[model samples]
Target: MLNLLGLDAVAESVYRGILDRPQDVDDLCDRLKLTEKEIRDALDRLSEMALVRPSTEDPGQLHAVSPHVGMEILLARQQAELASQKQRLEASRAAAAQLILEYDDRRADAGSAEAGVRYLEGIDSIRDHLAVLREQVVRELLTFAPGGPQTQANMSASRPLNQQLLERGVQMRTVYLDSIRSCTDTMKYVHWLTEHGCQVRTVPSLPNRMIIYDRKAAIIAAHTENTAAGAMQLTSQGAVTTLHALFESVWQSAEPVVRQARPTPGALNRQQAEALRLLAQGLTDEAIANRLGVSPRTARRIASGLMDVLDADSRFQAGVHAVQRGYLPSTPL
Candidate 1:
């Protein structure tokens, strides 16, 4: 039925009447109770779409074509259009791929030449390059992450890459915002990583999310602006070294996770104290969950409890309290 073709009710009726029996334009208009102009316009469109045909015997008579023939013609046109579209798509993809390759090669060449810095864009491209560097991590891995929307989102999406590094025995040391210590999902992921021998730590300071792999390659956010969503991967020895030094300076001041023990004496009841200790050390809620063998949400709740106890407004405040209480005497920032 013409209704099935998304035609209006009057148009469908006119089309069905004509298809059932060839109709003169006047009869089609009268039978369908439509104006002459409306019928004529519908018939013209149907004809153009190859859904209707003109009677050879009478110029004014019109007949609806077989649905099969209409479908065949429609399919043929669609196939042709799809083929053209595919060609264009392939051309575009090829051009984009070539541009990426050229950019990467040029970046490498520039690194060799000690030229100006290069920038990379998009999450997919960044992940792809990071996966390659992760494979090349032979000695050590260090990361600094400040909990924010973007960093958390990226970490969630980069699960496979993290698991891959763990499976390959890459030594990973990650520092995160003490605030993350309260996030349940982050804690579970941290537990997963630690179970596989990755060393994780926490610190109170807000260090931008950064990753240094094997002291030879480093990835850092280009700016503090949230508007930009890209990271810069530094491969040049000098740049990497500088980042490595910065990482180490922060790492040395970070609180190391004590994997072998639970909360120390009198720290259990004061969940805020424990939470403060963990945050000041830079453990995410996920890491805290794993460390405490608790659910991520529960770990976060405990952190919240700690916050309440300290009468502190933020994780940073709680961390400062822990330091003031001498929980972080050994690791001074």
Candidate 2:
């Protein structure tokens, strides 16, 4: 139909009316119940589209072109346009890639005094950015996960990524809070990493949570006080060097987390000890529950009992008291 070919309804009707033969505007107007001017306008549009053509015998009359011919021409033109657009996009992609390379070269020449810094505003953004950096890991990766053990979900997400990095021959060294070793989830992930040739160690505390990629770039929590707010990528020589140095200093003093989960002779049971230990590592009760394979309620009960024994008013206080009493080992056992 002419309408499907981009003609108005009036144009479509006028074209259809004279498909078998040519008709002038006045005849089309009478057949379509339209004004002569409307018929002329319709015919003009149809003519422009090649849907209708002026008859060779009578220039005043119009007839429809065979769809096989008209539509084939339209479709061929559309295909050409699409191919042209694709080529333009391909050219733009190449230009963008070149720009990125040039920018990187400029940054390298500038040295560590300047930085390629960016802030990832939300958790999803932070993770996505980190994922990109992880993929680009060439030789080495260093991560410092402060506070405590990772949640089951976090551990699960990291499993395949860590596995892939190792598969690519990327050397990885992760530093965790010593308390993470007490959690089942962290233990599992650490064992998996060690098995796959990743070096993992733990410190009692870290100043910030960060990941350094090949000493060329580093990602650190943006908020010094509230690291959960967002993350920042540091690509300046000075900043990256500072972070790398921090990681190295800590790496030297931190103890290697033993993959072997051993029973501790202390005031708490293994599950309760692990839960309390994670609490000291800066994990919430929810995280504690995830690691202990217990319900949140159960984890809280264990924490509450420990708090009562320590006579502590807050979770942090409970952690310190537990450590002081040897309920949670602060050093590698």
Off by over 4 Å in 1: 1-113, 148-156, 258-333
List clash counts for every candidate, in order.
Answer: 15, 2
Worst 10 residues of 2 by lDDT: 77-86
Lowest-scoring 10 consecutive residues by lDDT in candidate 1? 78-87
Residue 289, candidate 2: how far off, in angstroms?
Answer: 15
Native-referenced Cα lDDT, model 2: 0.66
What tens-digit string does per-residue lDDT give for candidate 2 at 51-149? 777788888777688768766544332221111122233333344334333332232223423547666667888888888998888999998787577
Per lDDT, the best of the predicted structures is 2
Q: lDDT per residue, candidate 1, 114-186, as tens digits?
A: 5434565666777687777777887788887664212566667667777777777777888765445556677
Q: Can you give the TM-score per candidate against the true fold?
A: 0.43, 0.46
Instruction: Let me know the TM-score candidate 1 reaches against the reference structure.
Output: 0.43
